[model samples]
Target: MWPIGRSFSSQNLFLCLVICQVVVCMLFVIYRNTQSLEHRLAILTSRWAAREDGFDFPEGPWNVTDSDVVRCSDLINGRFPSEAAINRTIDAIRETVIKDYEFIELTRDCTKFAWERGYYNKPITKEELDFPLAYTILMYRSVHQVEQLLRTIYRPQNIYCIHIDSKSPPLVHIGMERISRCFDNVFIASNLENVYWGTINIVKAERHCQKDLLNRTDVSNWKYLINLTGQEFPLKTNLEIVQILKEFKGQNDIRTLAQPVEEWTYYRHVLEGDTIRQTTLLKTEPPPDKVPVHKGPFFSALARQFVEFLQSDIADKWLEWFNDTKNADESFTQTLASYPNAPGGPGPIGSKAIISRDIVWSSERLRERRPCYGKFVRRVCVHSWRDLVRVSKSIRLFANKFHVEYDGLVLQCLEEAIHNKTHNPPMLTFHFIDDFSSSE
Candidate 1:
């Protein structure tokens, strides 16, 4: 028989175990509730802050609570928080070892939160508009910046094809996939290219996206194609863009110049493997078929008919001819645009047919100049806020080279301007050809 004191001690131990299990379960429930509350608070705060700052929130079914609004005012202000601050907040909840399920859940939840706060709301109505369907090719390295750009230019009527560089980190690929899944109109390109500046592969990457977009069952709906790097930003809203594109009246907006091809451009060069990092100059040879070489930058807003022509047998011949040429991207499209046999060729329209981009150069000339603003890497401009301010006054529908991490303020201000319709209200009034003809 056990002693009475020992019996009581054993009973007490069992009671303690029961109490501990209950406490642990209770704590877990509390933790989960707290997480849910925190997420709700973050969204509410973002929305309330936008409203308090005199910013116009898009009309939608936003999930906001009276208690949340009162609490949010204390936490959030009008200014956009820096990227670092956002990262810090996310890191607290995100595990160091990112599991796929966790990542997906996080992505879905964050996207939902942003939507609830009015970030993804449509500011315009969908109607029987004659606007050309916009086909966008977005090549990106920075996932966050790409997300911002996607959100800023999103329209239900448009189709977006995103291409992430093959060499980008794994996280970038995952993030892009998650973001792409959020919208039915958005998708990742089937083929990813390892891109290099001044290399043929750069042009190939664009072509890959174009082909992917063209192959879609709904390709017939898209009437215009705009190729943009991750760094580019829209200076006009969807309504304004549609209005400006309508002015083109089926004309292509590509830049082409009837200038002699530079010796470096035509010279035979061999790229080391698939990369442009190492190239060996081969013996110079005349361009195939003695095709007259025209020069232009890569940025373009092309008509569907012109893009269709590019997929034809004749374009295939030109592609083979320029396959060995240096800096092919700079000359390939220009040559095709000027080729008389090609459909929708420039013909008598000449430079008027080309209105691809507004580039600010150091010399302020069409040729023989580098970007005037931002640090030039590989001759392309990484534009700053000051440059954005100066270019904001121009009639260009889109502007090149904005790095959000470098200057988030510019993008934030531009977003505000676009949403508020403060910048260039006259653009909506249907101004004439002269307003848009100025060289960048």
Candidate 2:
């Protein structure tokens, strides 16, 4: 038993804490529920994923984060200035406009750039800082997209190696170089290759950057190397990416399938400078020393050790064999991922999520396959605003080919989502897998 005044004061304190908690809960509910009906519907509709048609590239159900749903809702709820206007006008804000590099270079201040353009300067988690990843990015076009993608993924702990195609506009190189000057970790490749599509130059460009990044002593402790194209955008925040890569446990997240070497190296491709012309249908010999041949996606998350393996003698012979091959970019990293002698090599077929990027290709026969709200460029789908809900919910680290010039709202909304997740992590995070298995 206590004195009457003391007991009363203790009860009063407990009651005040309960009142404070209740008020906080009520405020949260009101804030979340105040959005318009249409916004609520957008949130509700995101539960069911876009349908995947028959005979197309199949995938399982999408995983939606509650945190992403709120951000998507806010984009549609007119919380931001973009959504206050009509949809077309909102998206058009960034579609046709290019960044003014002259103005950017005037100050050349990182603090100003980060405040103005919203780059995440500090690491979100100790896990991300301790396990810094390296990036080898390919860029030829879309100045705004490249800059925004870099802004979103930029971190002090990580290193970035960008390879601007030698044939690209001078402004492209200038813009990238000026931006790179602001950061010690990001740089242009020592040797820029005149990248030609469906040729070995594409592979060489990546090799140049890989070598550059590997040689850097400042960030030599980086755990993995993630390859990206300028057009792609990250679906996950940097911290989330760090979390998923840890799931791979030491294995590289490369996708590969055993294929005949003749398939890609079948024709005698003549390269006069950057132009490629097939003169004769003569198949090249298989990989040297009977090393296995496999093919899959060009982009992947490779362990640092696997990158070291690539500099070895046998790997040199393997790369040389593909020098004259068509679309060798698609086979190089993937084929090397499954080699028995390769360090961190998981047996063939490593392309499972591992939370890396994705490319959507729709076949002509199944034209209405997985709905790409964005128009199809060549054969691959370039994502647009309508895909925001889907893209944000994906467990993958990033999704490729977002044409910001077409629908800038998608990128804006993704930015909002990442900003929200970075500042306030979700109450429950998706349990990422260690590797593909019976359950996946």
Candidate 3:
């Protein structure tokens, strides 16, 4: 009887220990979860604060930045300062404009000259630093064609920060300088660095543009920012473009596009199918270390709010996911932007959401000719002038793939077609022809 009693007590003690351990684990988990939730909430608050005020400026959204004030000042001082003056006067009611925000619309050469003579090496911070303004940056290697488009097609109303790589020699800079002279709005960065292929140098160069813009927020009034390659040409006039953008105003839809998982897989298998084997592909598992996941470079845009989203903790988690993966730029942005449960939720899909445009190519065709330029252009350009006339009537924007030599005719024809009185406000006028057209 004694022996049996002792055994029962021992078993009870063992069960108690197990229960205690389980309870302790549960407590630890709860505490950790609470801590995590608090951290997330703090980050959300900071992001919201940053969004309301520009990044690094802690004031309310109503608090105006110095750079914004400068552009407004420049606009007020300009020939067409009515709108600019009104906007500036309204902003000045809140606070005086900072110096960095002042528009250096004098001339690209003059600005570059000033920069070379130690103008902006040290950024203006909020304290001793002026309210750093975001500069709007435009990057492209091929400028000759872009210059032609800017000169002949549509000149942007706002001054733009333009950079061409140093490899093109003094002639490119000279050409850009000439362009700058004609339009005070185009400022060229003279200190061009050699961009090494397949390295982060290109990315860093772009970031430099972003940093410059971020540092000097006064010159830029853009709530949404676009990163355009020199190859990218705008199909619409500035008035029409602004009109279309006005529709999306107030509604913050930060756009960051990514190839869908299926699309990513398609690229991966198409590139690696022969070596990867059918059986391995059929396994339906995550890619092994031996196989690289495929991703492509993107031409993307982001709203100011979306940029804040990138700075948030949510983006850190996203970075960790793609840190080791190749072609992470494509994967990270797309996945985070599309992830349903992500903070701030999924971003707008693409130009389709803004206005319908075709960019499709068959897998077989793409395989036969990787990155078909003419086909891409023809997707919108169509055959003959008649086809373009019919198609342009429906589509707001169109892009072409042919060399400038081949595609120049298409552009001229497009400009002429839109100029026709019958075209009504031009084909570009229909961009975002929704309920909001009357507002402009």
Best by lDDT: 2
Q: lDDT of each structure?
A: 0.60, 0.70, 0.39
- Give a tens-digit lDDT track for model 2, residues 1-440: 32235587788877777899999999998878754332322211112222221111124443433332223444332223333343555455665567646535733786687667766544366667888999999999866788889889988889999999998988888888888887789999999988888898888898898889999999999998999999888876787677667656667777665674564566667787767777667755757777666777787888888888878787788778888888888787767766767777852222343347656677635444446777888788888765654466665678878776677777777776777666754332232352223123
Candidate 3, residues 1-440: lDDT per residue as tens digits? 11223587777877777899999999999888755632422211101111211112222223233342322112211212243543444444324321221223323465574344332332221221111112233343334455534433323334355667666555556556665565444566644545533222344455455545444444555554455545444444333333343445423333343343553343222123212211223224444232233333334444545555555576565444443333444544445445454443333323322231223343435432223324434243222221232233322333422234333433444444333311232222222344222221
Task: List where candidate 3 sits over 4 angstroms from the true fold.
Answer: 1-142, 152-157, 181-184, 189-203, 250-297, 308-329, 335-387, 394-402, 416-440
Q: What's model 1's lDDT at 96?
A: 33
Per-residue C-alpha lDDT of model 1 across residues 134-220, encoded as one tens digit per residue: 555556466766766777777766888888888887877887788777776788988888876667777778777788778887534
For all predicted structures, in order, the TM-scores are: 0.69, 0.78, 0.45
- After TM-score superposition, the amount by which residue 54's alpha carbon in candidate 2 deviates from its true location, in angstroms, is 32
> In model 3, what is the error at residue 392, expressed in angstroms?
3.3
Residue 169, candidate 1: Cα error in Å is 0.9
Ranking by TM-score: 2, 1, 3
Please report, as a residue range, the 10-residue window in candidate 2 with the lowest summed lDDT. 40-49
Off by over 4 Å in 1: 1-106, 109-114, 117-120, 125-129, 273-289, 347-356, 363-373, 422-427, 438-440
